[model samples]
Target: MQYTMPTIFLASGSPRRLELLKNLDLNVRQKKLPFTEKINRRLSSNKIAEEISYYKAKQAITHIKNDEILLTADTIVCKGNEILVKPRNQNEAFEFLTKLSDTSHSVITGVTMGIPNKLSTFSAETKVYFEPLSKQEIHYYVEKYKPLDKAGAYGIQEWIGWSKIFKIEGSFSNVMGLPTHMIHNYLVNWQKS
Candidate 1:
């Protein structure tokens, strides 16, 4: 089936995801979903992101027009079996950073895309390696960045990532909460369909 390019209604409040999608030059519209996001710990670390993204997309279906696709996404940080969600406070942010110090963790972003009643979901994973973080460094980052709104209590494009993150594998955009490379390809193929 041949399809024309459609406007994408982004049903997320993440500034990073918005900027990432806008940078791609897609016809993007930001829409707010009326729901509080919750992470289900019963899911494995890798599956949690996608599941939440799917839920968000389903919730957004009512707001989407027939010709417009709704996009929703969720990001999660995982260290071993533990999923490190957004920190609740400065102390928790510090603790989360401490746990991530001098170690490798996975940043997984799950993206859902389609019009109402029809959606597809996928996840992108990035392995990020952080250099050992000192207490002072972690404290400074928590106080200055105020990463309470970001998953993993940190943003890869922020100061913490600049100073502490030494290496990464996979999409950098994925670490920021959207996988642009994958999203670009998906949009191209979807438009063709």
Candidate 2:
């Protein structure tokens, strides 16, 4: 079978994901999905991530052209069985960081890609370890970085990433909210199909 690149659309509001996609040199359009953003409700982290990605992809389908290939993704941070989503305020950010410090957590990103009738879904997981953080460091990070928009109260590509992240055990991009290598391979294979 022969493959041809289709017009690409990214169904997410994450600037990090956008930047990563741009780094790949693919001309992709961006579309934010309409859905509620709430974590720690009652669903499993993996289930929530997949469901959210699916919902986002479904929403994007309504607005996309038939020829445009739509891609949607959702990322979640999991510590043991608990899901740590984006903080709603500074206090939550503080608490989240304190709990994550010196511990290993998994970052899961679920990705969906489709064009009208054809749809595929996959997810990537990365384990991130943070060095033990000081109270002063946590306070400074929260106040200076304002990480309310990021899951686990920090960005792995930001100042915190440079100073705090001790190690990572998977695609680094996944920790940043998108799995570039997996996404690229999926896109390349999808185009072939």
Candidate 3:
């Protein structure tokens, strides 16, 4: 008998996450979830990520087949007590970047994977430190990169991350949106079981 791995259906719109999975040599199919991401301001930054990812996974599971596993993820940036989600406009991006200048922020990514009634969830955190960014530099990045779609109004793989971010204390892939190391391990163990 030939055994085959179950198909993984990625229920996220993030191209970066898809790219990371592909780079890790995983078999994945992207499926956009109709669920809209809504943050609960009452939860802690870490809980917020987990809850969102869980809800996303819950929605995606309904559409998956018995031979497929649904995967959902959410990433958030926290500066001090503030949770910085995707910027609504250019001005908001500038504000977010300005606040991140010369400070450390936490990037938390929550992941959920499962079939029908069974599920597994986890979160990875990365602390990113930024060098002092001048007003000119922040403005330039906001205009050039147009990071309105990214949480914290920045992409860790972009120019701002290259020049402004000085250090990071955790998983790089977590900051990018998915914690591939953890995901890889989970997938391997699940296949063995």
**Residue pairs in collision within model 3:** none
Point to the candidate with the largest lDDT: 3
| Prediction 1 global C-alpha lDDT | 0.88
The residue-by-residue lDDT of candidate 1 on 118-170, one tens digit each, is 68999999999999999999888999889999888999899988888999999
Model 3, 21-100: lDDT tens digits are: 88777678897778888999899888999999999998888878777788999999999889999999999999999999
Backbone clashes per model, in order? 0, 0, 0
Model 1: what TM-score? 0.94
Pull out the clashing pairs in model 1.
none
Instruction: Please give the ranking of all candidate structures by lDDT, highest first, separated by commas.
Output: 3, 1, 2
Q: Is 1 or 2 the stronger prediction by TM-score?
A: 1
- Candidate 2 local lDDT, 41-155, one digit each (tens): 5776767787788777777787787667788888888889878888999999999999999989999998888877677888889999999999999999999999998888899
Off by over 4 Å in 2: 1-4, 38-44
Each candidate: RMSD to true structure?
Answer: 2.5, 2.5, 2.1
